[model samples]
Target: MILTGDIGKVKTLLALFSQEKEAKEVARREFYNKEYASLQEIISVFLKKNESPLKEEPIFIVCFGIAGPNINGNCQIYEPDKLDWQFTIRELRELLTANYVEVLNDMPALGYAIPKLAESDLVSFNPNVSAEKGNRAVSLATGTGLGELLLYRDRSGDFLPSPSEGGHANFAPRDNWGLEFLTHLYSQFSPPISWEKVISWSGLQSIYGYLKDRKGVKETDAVKNRLNREIPHEVILDMANQNDELCQQSLKCFASLYGAGVGDLALRTLAVNGVYIGGGMVQDILKKEITKHLFIEAFMNAFKDKEGFDKTKNFSKRNAAIPVKAFINQEMVLMGALQRARIMANLD
Candidate 1:
């Protein structure tokens, strides 16, 4: 199930899934998404043609990253819910007559890709990016959801992968200002705003909407309609670029939230070796200095929550808390799945 095939280089991954009648039928009838069926069908054909039958059980990893059928490098685990229990790799391969299956979360798939990339290679799984040095590495990706991955050489000298669901955790507002903002957000929203609520794409629009309403910012009819509907990060960015003060404020708030969140994550994990910003928002905001300022301020300010770790000088170093430096601009999850497939199948 771990398909490492290039998404950018190849859009139609028919080679991974079989196009046979049985596989196609299972994909179309059993799965909600037709792309899933197509993928399985293609892979089944490839495996059957090669005649590499699985032993007792086929070991596979279903990677949910990027677009459905593109080999784009700048993809992330945009939609992982597609691989829920209903979409089993076993059933997928069964349609194709394959024998084994394994399912892995997208974050770990990126971790799986680390060893395949050269030491100096600047690679990423797009929305979820990571960097590595020797056997130690770190990955962080956020889109519809948030996840973290840590890989290091254990005492036994084996590289192991770790996963985290940091997005679902509560938000750690930085200071009185952030607290006020959080209070405002909480008062408006239901209660106990999940980190994902503030960090996810919709989260960004929610912040923008709040700012727009508070400031009475005059937006275009289209913008207002979009705001009332689904406001994308790019639309907000465009407003900021147009010198819209309200948009600027919204962006600032986003940066602060992002910084505080990442800082808390670093402290919790001690990701000193390197930290990566892998999420649609991070990629968009990284291009501007204001975004960096807010994120840096809020993230470093988290140290104030504790002693020893809150030292001011720690924020000055660029390497310790690099942003987007090790972005996985590639379909890292897919690549990781491919590398893992190679390793597990002893193809390496």
Candidate 2:
């Protein structure tokens, strides 16, 4: 069993290896984090649902790709502000009786999954910019929370993946509107607000609320009722698809800021090999929102934004070499967890 956990939901994928030893899916289920008391319960449900398979086949390994708190320490999912559930490794080992059990931060799991990704799994908005052999790469995912992973080329020419909590890095403002947004966040949430505040599902909603309440962008009562009744991001995307002006405005803001934030990461990491976008939510917008081009433009502008480089063609040329690609697979995180699990069990 391979599981991936985030702030909003958890996904479990039951996989078996093919004749070539590649992991193939057997079953899958998604659980809302709020509905379950802990990760143990979620795993128990998956196990119970597949009683027949385990009875004959047996689960040899169990791995979890989770965000938040350290896997080696408390075995918890994120902090209290996020999933807030905790389970020790010992308990899981006992529950599964698997030969190997591994749990890690989702970023590293994503890192493990990158090199294995095929051409079909990757897409870029700018067709002219293709991935190249560079010294570094970075993966940034925006879901219920923001996630980042860094891949550095070693002396042997292989890219090594490493986990980073860079999403928790401080939010930087680029303009007057951004400065005002920062001030708004400071007023409500505690200090040391991170980029996750401006780049995730809740982040987009925060942007929408800011526009409606402070900037006075119009919002109708019908839209308000739908937002209250349904998922905010889903409703926001639905309204944007229907050409709701305020929803479109908020989406533009979210996409632009998300692009800008990624630009900062590209510069900071010098990720010339590739800048991979990995979350399903971000990809959903890239597929659904009409203003995806705005995201590309904002990304390029911020990526090339450098002091004394406004007139330098060399700066733009060097920055332009950074390839930005989005990973569209919804089960990428699960695939990643399976990859690690296979390695742990010596099945790959």
Candidate 3:
């Protein structure tokens, strides 16, 4: 069995696999925060719904990927205010009566699944660049919050994933506009705003709010009503697709900030092999028209700016040439957790 927790998004995904050497997913389900408050509750409901699989096959091995740091097969969720929600491998083993349970940070799971991804599972933004064999790679995801990971080649020429909390690093403003944005965020939120404050779902709302209040942009009555009724990011995206001027500007700002964040991740990790943008928001944005214009432009601009460096050295240019792609596989996190389970069972 494989379970993945996106604590930032307040959701958990569960998948059950057959016992063959080549495990196949036979059942899957998703649980949201509105329905379950704890991992134990999620497990109870999952087992009840998939009782047939349990009775027929009887799961023995389980792997879980969770948001936040994992220490000795245990993890705690800390974003959107800290919670008592915590999980441990030993406790999960007892609850599920499984022989083995392994817990890992979710970002590393995404990293582990990268090399295994099929070509069809990706949408490339940089088609001209090729991933250099055995070079390092980085993955950055922006959703409920930001998540990052690094993948390095081992002696056996296989890439191994290492988890990171780089997303929590301080936000660095790159230009006058960024400085103003940071100042605006400081006035609205507390000081020392991190990248998550500017690159997430809430970040989109923040941008819209800034434009409306500080920039004197007008919001349509329809957009205002929908914002109160639905998720702010969704409403903004929908309006932007419909060519609402204020929402369109807001989305451009959001995409530029997202691109800047990606650049920072690439530079910090020196990801020569590639950089991957994941999470559900990227998928949704790609489904619209914003991707073709602002997102890639802002990404390349921020990616290729090495302040005070000689243009002849081409440091920024070379780094900009690193392949960047959007991870389109919804099952990536599950696949990664399954791979970890296979490793624990000595099946890999």
Candidate 4:
């Protein structure tokens, strides 16, 4: 007998289901150049490649948006554009009876999961605020697209997940150099590339493409070669380390804007309590560009109303008594997902 699992019956999101090897080696080489592709196409490509011969056990699928905090398993069916506003359990039950549905904030899961991966305590901070207590953790991933998340811990030794559409937040440029970079970026993309657009992995291409277009170098070949040969994070850092003029300027634009964006989130959430920087790109920055004094300088550059903001800056300052640290928990998202799953299962 064939038994079908109710979509809502899923306890937790198992893991991101994209065909990894296929995505990197095959799908990406074949179909990833487009701006966006249908979900069906993505699923079809993924499923076609992973042909596992096994019994058709009743399986639960947990789904959530990149920015959604809640882990409702039914977001897939509602079809609404906004993730937070998507369908709830009641609606999902209308379609399937045997399935379970869960909703969770993606960022918190990532934040919580990092600690699990790293097997250590984590300090997570993201641009968006989750209502949970304790320090927050946030990250932005740019492999296939942008993913923004928040991580928090409560008194019960549980991670409270929160998610944000922060990657879509407005871009705030600092310094004349930043202004120039933004201007150049805007002139190229029709809708205009925001910080999220410029800072992500794909965004680096956007940056390189924009630079080439504005400079009128007629070197699409050279730019693509750079992307294929070097990751943006490495290229930016290498340029900075070498102190090349254009590379320095590009990195300066990136660092200043990035610091400001982080500061803004810090202010909004009063993350003076704690703030962390993670993501594939941040790893490169910390390894290459981060310094206490310079970090503080770039961060404070955005506080326009100097007096109170300045005072608060001191209070929230990263210092010896309360130092800022990396997430340390590398597999945070997976752990968080499992924790959420366990909670959903009501395990002891």
RMSD of each: 8.7, 3.8, 3.1, 9.6
The number of the candidate with the highest TM-score is 3
Q: List the candidate 3 regions with Cα displacement exceeding 4 Å.
A: 1-10, 19-21, 32-38, 41-58, 77-84, 134-139
Residue-wise C-alpha lDDT for candidate 4, range 62-160, written one tens digit per residue: 323233333434444222441113445565344323254444444555654554444145332222323323555454644333455455567776545
Off by over 4 Å in 1: 1-85, 96-100, 115-141, 155-159, 214-230, 286-328, 346-348
| lDDT of candidate 1 at residue 66, scale 0 to 100 | 29
Ranking by TM-score: 3, 2, 1, 4
Q: Please provide TM-scores, in order, for all candidate models, with all chains considered together.
A: 0.65, 0.81, 0.86, 0.56
- Show how many residue pairs clash in every candidate, following the order shown: 31, 1, 0, 34
Q: For model 4, state the Cα shift of residue 124 in Å.
A: 11
User: Order of candidates by lDDT, top first?
Assistant: 3, 2, 1, 4
Tell me the lDDT of candidate 3: 0.76
What's the lDDT for all of these models?
Answer: 0.52, 0.72, 0.76, 0.45
What is the C-alpha lDDT profile of model 2 across 78-129, one tens digit per residue? Answer: 4455457777878878887877777767677777778778989877756687
Cα displacement (angstroms), candidate 2, residue 44, comes to 5.6
